[model samples]
Target: MGIVVDLNGKREPQPSLEALTRLVAADLKAVNELIVRRMHSPVALIPQLAGHIVAAGGKRLRPVLTLAASRLCGYTGTRHIALAACVEFIHTATLLHDDVVDRSELRRGLASANAVWGNKTSVLVGDFLFARSFELMVEDGSLEVLAILSRASSVIAEGEVAQLVTANDTETGETAYMDVIKAKTAQLFAAACQIGAIVADRPAVEKEALESYGMNLGIAFQLIDDVLDYSAKQAKLGKTVGDDFREGKITLPVILAFRRGSEAERAFWRRTLEDLDQKETDFDKAVGLMGRYQSLEDTIERARHYGAIARDALGIFADGAEKDALIELIDFSIHRAY
Candidate 1:
């Protein structure tokens, strides 16, 4: 939906995070500086390993949400900057642990911390990041913010455990998959947004609205990520296509494909995903099955549904550049597959 073509057959520019990034540019710079300063440590490896992942360069969407949300709610204070850094720390910690759990070698096209340093160091650095996040939260000196972020941290851990239970299980349903992503991914988004309203001393209604927007946007974001795992375009973008398939991670695409396939196809899924007895050709075969079942397309459609909800949730906010950028972010999140 984001793509457009003129009579000349050239694809027009699609929706992007540029607007949001530009809107929060200065605050983002502050957050980045704070992150670099806080990640420092006397233990040489701590900074080294942490710096590696930090330098790997992601979109920093979670922290951006914090910055944008605070501005949207008319906050003029500097508190959001440190809090945004806190959110980034939480996200970076999760990525470190996730790469270790998945035995991944790459992150944002660079060697993952775990791949370079071993699982022990990666995990310890992740713990350090988590500790740093909590320290930032405490320094903010808001019990409500503390409660929100602490709850998100616990929910994220629960989501990871839930995903582990559902992993490699072809019988996992769509509902269960949604639950895992909402917790592991969306909980922090919600917290990041809600705290912005809190810091601004906005009303409860505004807080709830922003929370809902972040939650739904996060779900849409993860759904597309799952679809990207099977997309050829993902490889060009530096992500390893079919990582989910190789890891036996039962994402929405796999769940839908397995549910719709014939009995023979189901057995194929069990062999590749459940039993983890995969040959090199299995990834192609799996992608073919997903194509046959229209699973990838349907997953995109599912993402659109959540994106719609996220857009609507922003209805409470007044029209401004912050709101506009945030709304565009929903489109960017869903249409990034292109």
Candidate 2:
């Protein structure tokens, strides 16, 4: 809520991804090794295509969640390493599928997997990753872990399909949008964090606590992504600015702006977004309207609410560097848009 100076730079006192990396450095390294090891295949193109996306340098937050939460619960075993890798594979598979669904050309500052390789290849590789992830889960030999992850997988798919169904219609309510994101995005985060407790043989109360943290954090993360789509410069944000607009995606910002605008403004949105009749200046006009209505700021503010919840969910853990970093990570999710 303080003054946002550089729309490109992070807010002051934001959680450093590097700091979190350092906290989980050794486990992360082992997870990365396991990721590479499990990705190998007799089929030449499988590893070739999957490696391209893996090498693209995503933040790896999902896997880090697994590693960090396990350590937070004082788990010291090596099983968490492979399980962390499984989390990454699930995330990577979703990204591959999302790019194809979104028809995105660029991914994480480079060509999307579907862009460089064909859609068929991208999808098959995604499937392969999913299968590989299950292999690791089964190898871990915990039916509870498998049940949690597989349920997450199904919920994620349902979330995507729900979003797809809601795609261009301007009548989508806040409740509907919340449901879609909770399923599509927050479910994975919840599952990822909860698995850390499972591996630690922690009690259900601790598992639910981690799940709450991850779920709210994921909600905050996606809400910021919605804010950044309109507020960030294309080069800095990586994905093209106004992509959601172009794709006729109904994000929170657009939803707020649409609902708050005048009849003419609503008509304009319907013409461009609902009717797929965007002009070059339409994007700027949309931004102007959103700014006038304070939609972006409002969206960021909502993100901060969920972030606060994510932080409070960690109250059960005693104070330590791990707990501190996790709290900061929540701040990082909301403040990254600054």
Candidate 3:
């Protein structure tokens, strides 16, 4: 029931992002074309590197949200096409920057841009993408759209800063961590969905509903990401099992486990995470502690709670393929962690 059917016409346990993409296939094609067109520059490396990452596989979820939201609002114009491209540019820029900041060696199971071209090139290219995103926003010619996206860009930066401040603190509370995810990750999602309503000239209530759906969905998405880092296979998760642990990134499972563990467990987290004094065995120990506290499962349950909110936010809309796809996407996002 998660999806209609795959190309092979078999039942799928959940709706694939590919199925969602097919729902707005033509618009996604235009968005891809615009992505390549806008990334063009006289500087060869700018386009080359940008193309490499853009062509690298991604769900294009943010842009897809914009496109689907427009359709859900019953808009038929092509304006959403360019604006969808804008959302993508913003997302790509953030990925380029995140890989650099995390000092990551891999992305999407490939060498990270920074790893291949050095941190300077990666950072500059990220800046270039950000500038390109602004240009697309300007071209869209909607002051409201521009304002929402611009504020989202600033909020994303603030979220990154907040994460840096809270990193490896071992005392990062659920509230503070939620704030970081809301700002850094959810803000763009909220903006992306809201722009659809804006372009469709929908009223404030619908705009708020889509925004809420995006925000809650994003929280569910990131929470699952945190859980999968420890629980999912590398092939499934597309990153090392302990990347967060190695980087000392404080996420929900770690937050919950640390708070719920014994005194010795707290000292252990301090030794490995706060002190960055880790050995190969440390990851195993950390995993054991997380399991002992039921942290991973608990985190996924929290994600389900947010997923329910995301679904409810869309209740104002009648049942249809778009709404069903979005609801399925929420389930997909949460279950991907398992």
Candidate 4:
């Protein structure tokens, strides 16, 4: 989760939080410089489209995680900044393509890139960003970072394909859901933290521990995202409620609801999912049914489980403000805006 902690008086120090905010503030400038320089290049319309989306404000969670993890490992270097920017570039690229595929209208309270630019341009620009991210990673010159990010990007691509194939399939169980979330969300989180360790040249044990922490944190973060899709206000979410249902993306809450609902509820799930285009009332009824059954609570409990595991993973690190901040981050992911 990309959380900004208010570290006020009479409390333990928070090195990770402090470092993360500073890194974001600083490296965001670097990324913007790179974007503008590239925009002036004679690339295709796709690169131009990508530049627009990349400049749009987001929490910059992946890059922040990279910088924080490196600081927690006692790193003192400028390369971490460039590496963090690389992570954000890759993440932004993924979003441009994802919005195009999902046919989404809104993201981060703004019109989606694909909404303004055509799908072809969005996808092509996303590819340019991906290539640019690789160039930045190579500049960092850490073989481990390169390997970790490369594998993670591959896993993310596979996860998106899996999601498209499994959407609206009620037979999708918890195991399948876990696989999808781990690949799509957790992979990048794990890579973000692992790269931090690589940049710091930390021992193998500590690096692996941070990777575990990030993977659990990523899973928990996505779990909350899934819950919010059904529960949050449209303004807060920057998107419509039941948007996933309308798109036939059967997330954890919907899966739980399907398993626990009565026969009529089961039939309702089928009607909404199997039918090509469902009415607005159909989506509304599905939301009402899930609310009645407390399916959101079930999903939240699952998120809490992963959050606890992430916090526990931090125990391997020596007690410091950085570790304290990491623990609080887990809490933020669990209790966030639900």
lDDT values of the candidates? 0.94, 0.90, 0.89, 0.78
> What overall lDDT, based on C-alpha atoms, would model 4 receive against the true structure?
0.78
Clashes of each: 0, 0, 0, 0
Task: Give lDDT tens digits, candidate 4, residues 1-338.
Answer: 24334546444333233444653566556655655564454755655676567656766778778878887888877777777777877788889889988998877777888898778878877887788788877887878788898888899999999988887788788889999999999989988988878888889988888899999999998988888777755446455676688778878888889999999888888878856468768877887887888888888898889888888877878888667667777776666534
Please provide, for model 3 over 56-166, each residue's C-alpha lDDT reduced to its tens digit, 9 standing for 90 to 100: 787899999999999889898999999889888888888999998899998888888888898899889989988888888888888898899999999999999999999
List model 1 lDDT by residue over 1-338, tens digit each. 24679899999868988889999999999999999999999999999999999998889999999999999999999999999999999999999999999999999888899999999999999999999999999999999999999999999999999999998899999999999999999999999999889999999999999999999999999999999999998987778788899899999999999999999999999998989999989999999998999999999999999999999999988999999899999989988776
The TM-score, computed over Cα atoms with residue i paired to residue i, of candidate 1 is 0.97
Question: Which residue runs of candidate 3 sit more than 4 Å off their true CA positions?
Answer: 1-12
Residue 178 C-alpha lDDT in model 2: 93
Best by TM-score: 1
User: lDDT at 100 for candidate 2?
Assistant: 94
Score candidate 3 by TM-score against the native: 0.95
Q: Tell me how far candidate 1 lies from the true structure as C-alpha RMSD in angstroms.
A: 1.5
TM-score of each candidate structure, all chains considered together: 0.97, 0.95, 0.95, 0.89
Q: What C-alpha RMSD separates each model from the true structure? A: 1.5, 2.9, 2.9, 4.1
Q: Which candidate, 2 or 4, would have the higher lDDT against the true structure?
A: 2
The parts of candidate 2 lying over 4 Å away from their true place are: 1-12
Whole-model lDDT, model 3: 0.89
Give the winner by lDDT: 1 or 2: 1
